[model samples]
Target chain A: MIYKSLLPIIITLLITMAMLNYLISHVGNEEVKALEVENEYLLTINVFKQLNNTVPKIFQAKACLLISNPINYTCNVIASNITGIIMNALGIISNESSGVVRYEVVDYVIYGINNETIYYVTIKALTPMGDTTGIVGYTYPFNLCYYSQFIKELMNTLNANFTIDVENITVVQSSLGNEIINRVKSLIGTSSINITINIYYVGVFRMINRSINRTTYLGQVSYTARISPNNVHTCNEITTLAGAFYVTAVVNRYVNNTYYFSINGAININSMVINDKTR
Target chain B: MVVVDSLVFPDLVITMILIIIILLLIVYVTNQLIELSMIDYKASMGTYLFLKCQLGNFTIHLNHVIITNGTSSSNYLLICPQLVVNGSQIGAKVYTAYVKW
Candidate 1:
C-alpha cells in the first residue's frame, strides 16, 4: 500500500518538473532576444571604426585625406557593402545601401594623450534596423614626441635660432622629408610608399619681399604620411611633428601608420610676437 | 517479512526498478524540451576597478551579478605600469576591462 502511494507522488513530481521547465523556457526566450537586440544596436554604432581601419587598398589615399573634415569620409563607408572584399566585418547583413553603404558623420574628434591618437567617429547608420547611431574610436599608438628623431631633425632643420625661411619652406620641407624617408627606408619605392607634409599657414596675410606675390602667414604644418602596411614604420618614425613649432595641432595619421606625438613650446606666433621670440 | 510473501517481494523489486527508469526518462525529456526553446540572456560591461578588483562579483546589483572585474596584468613584472593610476582613473592609462555577463 505504501509503494502504491509513493508511485502517485513520483508521477506528480515528474509532471511538476516538466511544467516548470516549459514555463521558464517559454517566458525567457523573448527576454534573451531583447538583450541580443541591444548588443546589436551598440555594435552597429561602433562598426564604423572597423570600416575606417580596413580601408580597401585602392581607396587609401582618398579615404585618409589629410584630416580636413575626415568625418565626411570616416562615416560614409559601411563594411556590409563590400561583400567579398570586406564581407560585413561587423556581420551586418540587413544593412544594405544600393551597393554603397553610407552614414551621416555626426562628429569627429582626435584625442592625443598617453601615447595614442584616438580617431573618434560618431555616425548615424541607416539600415533595415532603421536610423541606428554609433561611434567608432580608432586608435593608433602615437602622440609621444619627446623621444622622436623626427622632431629632433625638424628642429635641426629650423636651426638654433628657430627662423623658418618662409620663401623656401615648401622646397625645404620637401627635401627634408625626402632625406628622412631615405634614412628610414633602405629601399624607397614611389609606388609602395607615399608621404605628404602639409603646412597650414594660420597668420595675417601681408605682402613681404620677393617671397610672395600674395600675402603670407606661417601656419601649422601637419606632417602626415600615408603608408601601406608594407611600409608602415618607415613613415611612422617622424610622425610626431609638434616639437619645435608655434600654433600646432598636428594630425600625424597615415591610417594604421601610427605617428608618435610630441608637443613642446605650444606658443602661437601672432605677427608681433613672432620676430622677437624666434631669435 | 513473512507477512508479504516471496511472490509479493518480486513485485516490490519490479516497482522500484520501474520508478527509477521513469524518473531518469522524465529528467532527460525535460532537459531536451528546455534546451530547444530557451535562449540565455547576455550582457557586457566595461570599467576600471583597481587592485582590489573582484572577478565573478556583481558589477551592478540588479538582482544578478557580472563582467570585466579584474586588474593586474599577468607576470606583474612592470611595477610602474602596474601603479600608473591611483583611486581616480583620470588619465585613462588604466585600461577599462570589458566582459560578457
Candidate 2:
C-alpha cells in the first residue's frame, strides 16, 4: 500500500520537473531574441541622431552667404529660398526612409554673377550602428550637382537673366593634402589667379574612463585670393577684391571611430572688381 | 532500505537537471543583453564635419566640407585673403604648412 502511494507522488514530481525545464528553456530563447532586436533598433536610432547633428553645421555655415546681397535678391530672400530647398529635400528623404536615412552635402558648386566658371564644394556625413562600447560606422558621400545647374536654379527662382551649362562633377580622394593642391593646380594651370587653401582639423572627444577621449573628426577650408586682370602689363594695377568668402565646419563620426575637422576662410580676388571696370 | 534508496536517487537526479537548465538560460540572456547595449551606444554617436569660411567683413557659408588624402606629394596649405575689408576680398598671401601622418 505504501509503495503504491509513493509511486504516484514520484511520477507526479517527474512530470512537474520536465514541464518547468521546457518552459524555462523557451523563455530563455525568447529573451535572447528580444535582446538582439533591441540592440539593432538602438543602433539605428543612434546613427540617425549623429547624422542629424552633423548636417546642420553645413547649413549654418552656408547661411552666412545670405548676408551678402546679390544683384537682384537680398540676403534674407536668398536665405529663405535655400532654406526651403533644404527643408524640402530633408522632408522627402525622411519620408522615403521612414526616418532611417540621413545625409549632408559633401561637395557643391556655385557660379558667379555672369555664370562663367563654377565653384565646387564638398560635404560628408556619417552613419553609426551598435552600442557605445563597440560600434560600426559608415560614411556616406553627398555631391551637389555642377555649378551650372546650381546657377540655373538660382537664376530661375530670382528671374535673373543668367544661363549656364554644367560641364562635369567629380570627387577624387587624396591620400595626402598635396593631392588637393595638385588637383587645383591642374584646374587653374597657368592661370594668373593665385589660389590659396587653408585647411584646419579639429578633434572631437568623448568622456571615457574618467577622461575625455578623442571620438570623431571635423574640418574647415578657406581661401585667400589676389588677382590682377592683366598680369603682364598691370604691375601697378593690383587691387583688393570684394566679396571674399570663408568656410568653417565641424566633423564627427560614430561609425568608424574616426573624426576630422577644419575651419576655412576663403577670399577670391577675381570676385572683386573695381566698380569702374567691366571685364 | 532498498526501496528508500531507489526513491532518493531519482529525486536527486531530477533536481540536478533542473538547476543546470536554469543556469544555461541565465547565461544566454546575459550575453545577449551585453551585445545589444554596446551596439546601441555606438549608433548614438555618428561622424560629421562642420565647415565655415570667413572673408573680409563678409563670410560665405559652406555647410559641409570633406577631405581626402590623395597623393604622396608634398604641398603647402594656404589661406589667402587673410583679411576682408569693406565689401572687397584681400589676400594676406600667407600659407600654413602641414605634413601627412
Global CA lDDT computed for model 1:
0.35
Per-residue lDDT over A141-180 for candidate 2, one digit per residue giving the tens place of the 0 to 100 score: 2111222232233233222111111111011012223333
Best by TM-score, which number?
1
TM-score of each model's B chain?
A: 0.34, 0.39
Measured against the true two-chain complex, the DockQ scores of the candidates, in the order shown, are 0.04, 0.01
DockQ of model 2, rounded to 2 decimals: 0.01
Name model 2 segments beyond 4 Å from true. Answer: A62-279, B1-101
For model 2 chain A, where is the 10-residue window of minimal lDDT?
Answer: A164-173
Task: Give the chain B TM-score achieved by candidate 1.
Answer: 0.34
Give the CAPRI rating of model 1.
Answer: incorrect
